[model samples]
Target: MTNLGTSLWLQPPRNSPIWQQLATTIQGLKPIFSDSENFEPHITLTSNISVNTQGQVDFVLDRAVAAAKCVPQGFQIHLSSVKYGSRFFKKVYLQVEPTPELLSLARICREDFVYMPEAMSQARNYQAMSAEERQKIDTQVGQRAAEWTRNEYDPHVSLVYSDLYPVEDADRRTIETRLEDTFGSGYDESGLGWKNGRFALVRCEGPVDEWEVLGVRDF
Candidate 1:
């Protein structure tokens, strides 16, 4: 990775059979956001935890793996349903049925988030991130610590542009219509039961769109 900063993600196996099904839907919904398909698909462990070295990332991942306490290499996850509805931030999802391994991964990430605030201060532009924004970030991180640590962890991979606006607009409806035409409504759980195998560390590149691979841990 070129730049050093916060944020680490869990990139799923590159050549997995599951990506074929999920990619099609994710690609089809790309008009909603430019960054949706700009980077390889992934599920985040910690959105932001400051660090500046590949060694630190690998160390944290190793601990996270150990904290997992001998879970299976591939976790059996079931996609509950696809929904396109009233939520502003979310437009669609391949809702995950959180298995033990999945929950453990999330829990460990929270318990031992490798965030050195002093290190983060060096990386982050405090000027750009206003006091209010910093507070919000702090509050959100605190919330995730509790939320993902407990059973309240609602793990779901987004299928569309999560930040897209116009929730009730005609354009959104058109997208929704297309979604219905292609994937159908919330009631269908046709595609489920995938074994999520392997994990990679991704450095936050630019924004939420571009991500650079730091390391991989195959278990």
Candidate 2:
């Protein structure tokens, strides 16, 4: 909750019948990742702006609203596969098939959105990084951001939103097994569907309860 940045997200309909079920199911799957608040199911468009404070986040949002209006937003998302990393605290999520409109909108948003950088130091705060390596990061963050753009962007809707990190191997396996049990039932068919219309902004670092819906738009 300490690091501050802004991001754009496309939220599925809150009223959708499967919405509650999905959140509840994820929490029940494993206790290590459970939360009381129901996090909004979203596909991230742009995130981790280099702003330092909420005031700056507000400034970015003001510019983002108009650009968001210019782009269309009614693409039907197809969740086709389950994906997870062996790394600790990495989330389990459903892979989204990138459609023409979705791809186009991703490109458009990157071009239109403003990310005014006050600082980029927080990104390098890791134990393994040497001082020289961290200094190198100062030059290479733009390259990293590029991964989230164009053909490199891997679009997926996260099923868990926990900040738990450096998990042990046995714990990781237990969580993975629970996820397999919960969502591995239908690999052959498109798993579940939810109508998407709106996009919102929130602090990506905090708990679900700490997240605030900064702005919303419908297309």
Candidate 3:
């Protein structure tokens, strides 16, 4: 890795048989957002913050791995029915049921890698949340998240770009229904792989060198 300010993350490994199957299924679906063929499923841990040097990245990674090691291994999470976000409806998703461990891990990462105040200020909906509010939501689902869990964790990685707009309510519902009919009942539940956990810190543009390997971890 060449960049010092590379962001690190704990994500699912790529190249697993389960991921391959899921990707194939996603590619087969009519557009939901983007084909899963382009990527594998993974939960993002740390992001936005970056390591400035290769050595620094390595150190941070080692720390992250150690932090993750403290977490129990081989916990099973169920994949529930597929659901569509009415608000973010164009994108189809599989919601993950919140687990104590999952919530803890997410909280740890949030404390360490929260988006900077100025960074989020650019977004209209990105309001500055107090530490307390952040903590509360870290483990608890709000109204939208609660509704998502009604069936199970409908953890679908996006399948099309339908979330785009002006498709009438009926069309949106039709799209949502079609997605469930296509892959609603089934979900890929293979254990996460750590290899896909690897990512690079790159200049948001330019050459491949802009991409530098960072820390790797699994959800």
Candidate 4:
């Protein structure tokens, strides 16, 4: 597999009650699926950051630091619903409310990191594309990233990454029921929310299990 570059993630403070609850829930969910991987729960702020080279890595690190400095305090992140998707990473997860603060932070990270010169150059199939095709793909990439940053950013904390288990409506309901039994219903009622958190620059290369954290910044 090709390296998918880096991503900016918003992670709940490890010491927070919400974090502990999420950690426990993620662990508990593993047995329900035949093939599932354990992963740290987080909300992706921005993805597809170009960190193919040492210089690109350093550049992204600097941008992350700068972005972190923009928000001196932690912001609230509320869990709105328990949902499931076909995507491996989002197979089953908690949907986060699109709070203004969260959106603002996402925008900042996107502006700082998404359109780096290295982004287009490090495309997965860059070597196979003609110059014109590369330019077209580059434009598409930029436009998609911008659109996602501005209006389509869906924040969620993933609970499982299993290709074998497809979460249907019934399965989603069961999962929701289990979560409610474990952590109560709403974010307010169950303390399923974070008041503040940190940012991590993760190298999302290879398989999901192999993803590595390059650096972190606390707000």
State TM-scores per candidate.
0.64, 0.60, 0.51, 0.75
Clashes of 3: 27
Candidate 3 global CA lDDT score: 0.43
Clash number by candidate, in order: 0, 0, 27, 0
Candidate 1 local Cα displacement, residue 186, angstroms: 9.4
Tell me, by lDDT, which candidate is best. Answer: 4
Q: Which residue pairs does candidate 4 place in steric collision?
A: none
Candidate 3 lDDT tens digits, 107-194:
5544444433323444444347776755555444333233333332323344432435444567556655654454443333442222
Give model 1's TM-score versus the native structure: 0.64
True lDDT of residue 174, candidate 4: 70
- TM-score of candidate 4 against the unseen true structure: 0.75
Best-fitting candidate, measured by TM-score? 4
lDDT of 1 by residue, 113-163 (tens): 643353345646755877897776666565656665575556666666555
Per-residue lDDT of 63 in model 4: 67
lDDT per residue, candidate 2, 76-195, as tens digits?
667765566533223666777877656656655554453213223355444467878755754454444444565567677776655555455676677556655655666417456555
